[model samples]
Target chain A: MRAFVLFMCLSVGCLAQRPQPCASPPLLTGSLSVSTQSEKLMAYANYYYDALRRRIRLTEFGSYNNKTFHLDVLLLYREGVMYKMNYKNQTCCKKPLSADFHPLEIPWNASLLGQVVIGSSSGPGQGVLVNTWEGELQMKEGPAKYMSTVTEFGCIPVSTLFHTIRSGWMVTSFFNNVIGLVDPQQLIPPHFCQGAQLEERLDEDPVTFFSLF
Target chain B: MRAFVLFMCLSVGCLAQRPQPCASPPLLTGSLSVSTQSEKLMAYANYYYDALRRRIRLTEFGSYNNKTFHLDVLLLYREGVMYKMNYKNQTCCKKPLSADFHPLEIPWNASLLGQVVIGSSSGPGQGVLVNTWEGELQMKEGPAKYMSTVTEFGCIPVSTLFHTIRSGWMVTSFFNNVIGLVDPQQLIPPHFCQGAQLEERLDEDPVTFFSLF
Candidate 1:
């Protein structure tokens, strides 16, 4: 019994098999109630990044359709390791890289009835999504469909050259609102450009150069 | 001087703009900031869009180095229409489209740069785009490029049917993120669907969908 308890406790701290975020500093927790103005104020994001082990008996999956969602949350470390408990179905999927940012494409999966992948967002670190089952939906094309959009959401800055590689999330665009561009390399410098004066030039004249950097 | 003032006033309200926003509702104005998770929370945003129009100037565009940032705030609007104002330039770029709902490809004239546009975007109405220079952008690749990047952004939601189209400013993704695959048609319903049932559905299901009514 002692051994079993010890094992369980250690597992809770950090799954030996994955890369997950532990109790780091500056934690944010809350619930999103309003559909307008201030929905992002709620912290503590929820995701079944693993897609296989994450399962729930209830159908509500991170949606705000009036249901009071209750679930333990897990944030994947930069290494892209999610446990089996994040998805409804339990089929393991792995990627050398994660679909973490947006304007990204999520490979097709059998479990996700209808899927959309918004990744590598240019917003703050609040780049998340709200989805629902297809059984409850309606598809319509309207006058807005004929239009185009643009924005400068959370464009990556040129500052942290020796830290992490995560890009902050910017303003997300709904069907109506569009955001601008933000580069993540601003926080964590790519492996190639280490000692160069990238931030200074960027600050002097804020322009993103894909080729040079 | 009096005669000149009257002529200027008449042109000010009717400066070759599309119909004013009748469907757009009052929106909340907020600062554009990014959250950083260190010993403290760091929020940094720039008014470059304003600088493009010669509105206000910042000390720098980005950091004066080669490091890349993950998240920083960009200018955006959600009251349906976005406002692009160059107070110094005395030009405004107005668009009467929903940031979360509308998706029109307002034909761009490169000269539309630094101009501000504002109008109602709750549902759909005529929208416009203007540039500062010759009023036309260079066509780098496809007709779409010369047109505007809004088309590619539109493809995200438009590709998926029956998806939710938000009504306010949203966080967007540039390269990769995870919330990219939401079928706007699936989550969104008709603009006409409202009232008790709508509220009930939104409240009970942890899921969100759009109405085509």
Candidate 2:
């Protein structure tokens, strides 16, 4: 693929921003307790950035010695229906479910070619079930092309506070503790190396070839 | 799903802690045309929100197309190579190339044994790329469970302002422009909507199921 389009055009000439410090940075996982809680998280003006939280495009499977496991989707609702708190620590009894979203048929006037097509009576189901104003409800799947979204944030036990819990970072209120993993897709392309490996190309004319699987 | 998880646990127990002046805005999209020579962007901040510039990232397919076609996924470069006058309105007649780093593997090393898998003895060829980062680069296949990073901004076109250009809001700007089309296995999930299909079902009696395919 032309080297995946030249490794996606190698990093455009050094770009730099983020670091104003009007105070606001809940989590993005650079750690040192999120650079000292990003200066007390912008003192409530509408901050949010524990690595940009808001994602739950699930379908991940299991693995351990072979590597690949990052579960923590949990949405929680318990007794009525919907439940998907996969658990990271596996304790405190467990109870929070009510997520199915019937398959996102949601299309109110839709625009952009009906959000990419879905005329058929809303039965075949692709996904949709909105209600998130933070009322905890969003299950959107596919539309803007392959889409995936699942929401629920209001659960943090952290094994009752660090027996040893570090991955970038996160502590969230023992005294306002808020290290990493606030979500932002878990700080994309950051955490890796429990068994990381993907760079081998015994060169023929290779300066580098590392992602051609 | 339990009445949408009891209306998202009573709507995050009432606005996930209130606050919303600008907590997580910045996503802006198309039709763009603001550069009337404004530029003040977070200047040591003290309350900000022009709708926080247009706020984006509900998964972002460029916020479902309003800004023509914008998509950025964590574009930040520090000498690792990325320049085309810092990418805006696109115009790199070809010159800068060699700036390599192939380590795209991270499967699971946030701990808790996820197996971790992002290897590439040979993956991504080598050079000839774009997407320097100022927005519009989104593509991270199925699992980046750690989510690494993903960014994208809009309003390009300033090939040297003969036509007179150069606006603001590149999040502070520093060449955050990388339109790199590495095609990270994205067929559209946020609204790209091409072959998109997922209604899923495989039951026989649970509420008279057996539908999704």
- CA lDDT, every prediction? 0.23, 0.20
> What TM-scores do the predictions have?
0.18, 0.16
The residue ranges of model 1 lying beyond 4 angstroms of the native Cα positions read A1-107, A110-213, B1-19, B23-213
Q: In model 2 chain A, where is the ten-residue run with the lowest total lDDT? A: A204-213
- Shift in Å, residue A144, candidate 2: 31
Tens digits of per-residue lDDT, candidate 1, A103-167, equal 11111221222212222233332122212111111112211100112111121111111111232
lDDT of 1 at B64: 15
Over the stretch B1-213, how does candidate 1's per-residue lDDT look in tens digits? 999999998888686453221111111111222222221223233212121121211111222133433321112223323233333444444333222322222323332323211110211221112111122222223121111211122211111111122222212112222222222232222233222121112222110011110
Model 2 residue A191 CA deviation (Å) reads: 44
In candidate 2, residue B96 scores what lDDT?
Answer: 22
Per-residue lDDT over B60-87 for candidate 2, one digit per residue giving the tens place of the 0 to 100 score:
1222123333332221122221111212
When summed lDDT is taken over every stretch of 10 residues in candidate 2 chain B, the lowest stretch is B204-213
TM-score of chain A of each: 0.18, 0.17
